[model samples]
Target: MYPLIYGGDARILEEVLEGTHPGLSSLKCRFCQINSLNPNLVKGKIVLCIGHRGGSEAAWSAFLAGAVGTVIVDGLQLPRDFSRIYPCLHLALVQAMVKELPTTSAQQGTGDNRIAEYNIESGTSMACPHATGAAAYIKSFHPTWSPAAIKSALMTTATPMSARRIRKPNLHMVQAISILVQNLRLVTGDHSVCSKAMNGTVWDLNYPSFALSIPYKESIARTFKRSVTNVGLPVSTYKATVIGAPKGLKINVKPNILSFTSIGQKLSFVLKVEGRIVKDMVSASLVWDDGLYK
Candidate 1:
């Protein structure tokens, strides 16, 4: 199951609840206590329980009430150590809502007939399928591509969650498909196949994310080599841009401009890093922006 950590924001959670489950006017006493719940009302349905006591306790009560699944949401900031005992999802105050709730209907159906059914919930669990589906679609076209290559395509092409100001995977199927097609051609060569097959370091993995870690009281310089296979039209050039480099650190990318003459042609570059000693963490990103692609 895909797990998501919600940011701490009480107002956002309340806003989500007001829109989706309007009937749920009160969260203070809703399923906060086991004795407060009516089994008939909760049976066979997934329960959204308040995490006043704790997620574990709340989940147990929901299970006892015959809920198919449980969602624990509390307005307070909590540690990320909540255990996954059942099919349960925890939402932070910031990640208040992800699921699209169904609109309530006033008209009731006749006997032996039913109206449309709507299941509204939100979590990384619900979001994971979109990424998986994108992967599956790519696999269908390039049955010969290895899992690593497919993963690289997805990671390298994903949109950064900068708006949320968080470092995480935000899946975009259209972009993934485009990148997969281009990456397939680039990695199809005999020389590119080996590197594409093996797993590499996070920064050098052709991933969509960038991360740099410098241990406390340590001053060091590091260099990384990254390769790109030309899969687009022959004889195209791409330029690299570095943004948000941490202060007190020197970062450089050699041969920042890449030119490819043929499909499967490989180009390698070195990223040199020299930095002063740091007490806390430092972060930055290097992006390749081709004329047609970002």
Candidate 2:
């Protein structure tokens, strides 16, 4: 949309531009936003916005500019607080449109008639709602649960996923996010995970996901601390196993067998994750199973 507008402007100037190139369209999509788009060019066209910022109001911005529609393209998860921030931006835009002061140089708007009635959203739109809703839903069930506990519960119970396909592109999709907050039980509160001291590696937290920040070209000798609670059978022993460890990596879990005498019993363990520094991405998993749960 913006590209066509730029080409038309260049042609009108009697300029013969050589080759195809993007001129500030990407920047506008990232930083400049609505102010970057001119009403003269985008009035009746669909605007293509590429990135998702924490404070971005891309959808509302396009609608206010009289764009007939908008398309949002993103590569990552949407910022969690986006839904809360959206209504404020929407109201502010309404106020601005109403108080179209002659003194303000900013193009007030095209008009009420040109406002877009529809929008198409992908990546960002599909992800944020689920996260926000999950947190809200969990809080509804356990109002006393701290934010950190809710966060840990969600992370711990999360299903492992990747965009990898079973067949070709769009043929077989990876399983979607399934957060079973109902099955999650918090042992206790530990705000250290949210504090600045636990800024880098969160391996010590009470969650299934493990992470270790190893600097490049440095020796790969790091230990992770983790805790687990028994939510299944009261009297059972679970064995720890590491899968998909890269070659040359040695992972040893201290006291790998966890025995629970009763439900809600919590146990802690240490993982001595040692490996040689490699250029490729390190992908692995630690599974705890008692021939029942994995």
Each prediction's whole-model lDDT (CA): 0.56, 0.54
- Residue-level lDDT of model 2, residues 1-294, one tens digit each, is 333223122121112111233353434543215444555555666555554442235545655655555545455453322222211222221111222234432322344232222222234344467688899998998787677667867875687654242111332223322323333334243222322333555555555567666777466777878777676799999998988777778889888999999987989899887768575446677788899876
Give model 1's TM-score versus the native structure. Answer: 0.51
Residues 113-153 of candidate 1 have per-residue lDDT tens digits of 22234322334675567778899998998787677768767
In model 2, the Cα lDDT at residue 15 comes to 22
Q: Provide the clash count, candidate 1.
A: 5
Lowest summed lDDT across 10 adjacent residues in model 1 is found at 3-12
